[model samples]
Target: MYILYIFRFFIQKEEGMSCCSFLDLTEADLNLMELNMDRTEFVVQEDGSLISECNDDPNASQRIRVRSDIQERRNTQSMTGTNKVPLHMFSRFGTVRATLLHRVAEGQALVLAANGSFTENNRRALMRILISELIKVHGSCYPPDEAKVALAQAIVTEFPLLRNTRTKKGYEHYYDEETRRGFIEYRLWNVRRTLSPSQKKYKTKALDSGKTTPVSPNINLLSQEELDSKIAWMKCTNPSDSNKQNIATHLQETLQNRRDWIIKKSPNISQILHEYPRLLDYNGEMINNEFRYFFKEKSVNFLARFPSYYCPRILEYAKLNRLDVYNRLKNITDVNLRALFILADLLRINNAMLAQQGDKGKGKMKGKKRQRSSEEAEMIEKEKIDVPSTFLVRFAGTPLPQSIQEASATGSIIIPPYIVCTQEENGRNSYFVQGDGWLIKPRNNNPVTAFDLLFKVYFALKICYPAGLQIFYNFIESYVYDLGTKARGVVTSLHVNLSNLKLDKIASEEFIFGS
Candidate 1:
């Protein structure tokens, strides 16, 4: 009788009919069905039948189902469509649900109850598994908003009790559209945050944007032989009064060629120093000359306006705003240190304002929360200024180190065109310009001159301004150098600061002249 029943079950399965149609399945038979279902290995066919390898079947094919009726019901639902989740894709979730149901049927303890409600820990675990499977298909933790919504819909459809009816949509708790805050978005944010800098995809601004390109070299002016000879001479000759004039003249004649080499060829600082060794001259005369050649009249404006116009106005602005560093600024007598402090503070303030504005603009466009919460404001406030482009270091009767590595070892990265200020025995500050692997000591001991050299080198060498000091350099370019013509359309934090400075200047003038 047992053999006849087993043969009849095989005949029913072979005819694409459930064995339960012929005989009643006990709890042991249901448990056996659950244990035999290889959810991971099964593949759905074009006809919507889930098939897996069967060792006992003569055809080597077996139609598997979660239960006797699930396959028939799933097959009746149309699976062919764009943006439709495949039925087989939910097998893992179904398998997990079946296991939980089986445990509950057996009166075993579980985090998930038979009614589909689960503990917070179990819910998180399910979400993590779903997200992992989604990432496998989407190939990124940051899946499209649509895919996230679809997943949320699937979850709510499967478990009606988990659906949130409070919001406009039932799945908003899983993935909110307005604030872009919810379980999925929060998890994705964490995933992206944990990725290394190299793994993250970021949009970077072009190096030449909003800045003038260096003039192309006058290649026809000097023959290759003449250029080579001049470069060789500059490389070999030492800086002396008699040869200094010739070096300057040769440098002028070969100026375009040198600029071409630096700009077009884009050689590193070490290569530049190797090609034209005079760049490392103790007095930095050639460096200044090259800067003057590029900027011409604007070369002198930085020194002229910095102390008289910029410093006083900046200090006054800090005072009026009642900034934290105002008292510290008043106590610092060293003009160089005072200037560094101001630039650092300005950088921090500018970045914070920009971040706040960016967040506000995004919120407004998305029709989400417009006002920045205190947490957001605090995040902006906590932003640190970029490592100082120019800084001061005091030594106890020791000469400051010259190499980029030694000099920048304390806190900075010593990208070329960086400035280091040290106090001399004569109570004057000496500025050293760090190159790729070398340093240039300017003849002047003025902080303004140091800043001038720093800005000029960026243009002269065709190097991009350091990221931390971009706003500070932009202020110099737009205000000090009066090169705002190209950048007027783009209103930046620096522009706003400049506008405020102008307003303050006008207000002070009005008060002085009794307007």
Candidate 2:
């Protein structure tokens, strides 16, 4: 029998995700289900810890009858959330963290800390994690900055007495060896940032209702500035005492575990949102657009490639350690999921590089494969297009304001239509999917740059893909139409006569002037 397990993770924001996680286990996976409720078979203590011993009456702290019928139904239902996640996605890091985050946000986080691995960073990280989960469940406001700050304020206001701030002199103030005793003015960072009407309303609703959701601010702990200070101090002073190291190490582990747990447990956390719904709807559009600019042009040094439609989606999978992918690939299993958290921890180990290297078209450098069954790929591909017109995007007409920065590159891209041009036979067998789709390489392996994809598209599936899947059709159609615009930009015929090497580099870097 196939065992169905529903799970979650901790996604990080800035990347706009949470860091907690969970899992669903099918009845077949649970061996204890058949055991009839024999109270004498169990034991529990005052602290509610079940003692493992068979006595005349095994002490049970709390015994509530679990309906086997309800448990069976819970096992079979489809797990629902935003982000259109396929069930097969799995990440070692994602699974654990998602489970934790989901539990904590719902006020059911388990006590998994082992003797002092809980650092202040870990604690704040866990707290923030709960808040992110709330963001997902409640649907956070648009213009996240104002909404986020407003949320922070609501949280701050909840515990007026717990607020604390940094000194006016700053952290370096305490750096002086001799004058460490002077009274330093402390500056409190009151969570008074911008707030959208809806976010303010949500925070107010939660605060006034006397019910705290996950995203609600933590007024009880040190502020972000203070936490950073603590982290910084922890980093700066290498306590000679071995016990202090052990203590710091413990706190660090606890916090890391906490972060991982939350990230993996949450079902709704969307990671690396470069493009979805509206074209560049969130602030992440700029980096994504930059990638478009970087890859659209042909370059000699770079491999021939075009953008795949799933760039943002793939990025989410990568950073989020998509459980669907992990679960599907039995070969990889959950080993790599743990790898990411270990990776996060590994980063703390000094000069550790988590980047997996590969040879071109041979390894991950060749690329990673999508783990979904062909059926799933078809379903995802069938996803409705919510994007605006690409040609009409008119980057010149609108420039992103300076402050916003996106997370890592989604690395996947949406290739425009392949222009059907008759060419000499470079053929063996047809390499195109469906015998007539965009020729861009799949995201399963080493990422194909948009430049590399364009060439592949030129040779294969030479036709415009219709709307919804028009990313392919758009590229070739737009370029042919804009040929004159390219010609106009070329100042001199001699400049155009440059070698293929130089032309390719220039083209890849610039949007205009390329084959």
Model 2: weakest 10-residue lDDT segment is: 182-191
Q: Per-residue alpha-carbon lDDT of model 1 for 178-210, expressed as tens digits?
A: 666666665676678777878776533433212
Clashes of 2: 122
> Could you give the C-alpha RMSD of every candidate to the true structure, in order shown?
20.0, 29.5
Residue 480 Cα positional deviation in candidate 2, in Å, after optimal superposition: 25
- Per-residue lDDT over 374-445 for candidate 2, one digit per residue giving the tens place of the 0 to 100 score: 221232233422222221111223422211111012222222332121223772211111111212222221
Best by TM-score: 1
Candidate 2 residue spans exceeding 4 A from truth? 1-147, 150-321, 326-451, 455-515
Clashes of each: 0, 122
Task: Candidate 1: give the clashing pairs.
Answer: none
lDDT of 1 at 274: 78
Candidate lDDT values, in order: 0.52, 0.26
Lowest summed-lDDT stretch of 10 residues in model 1? 1-10
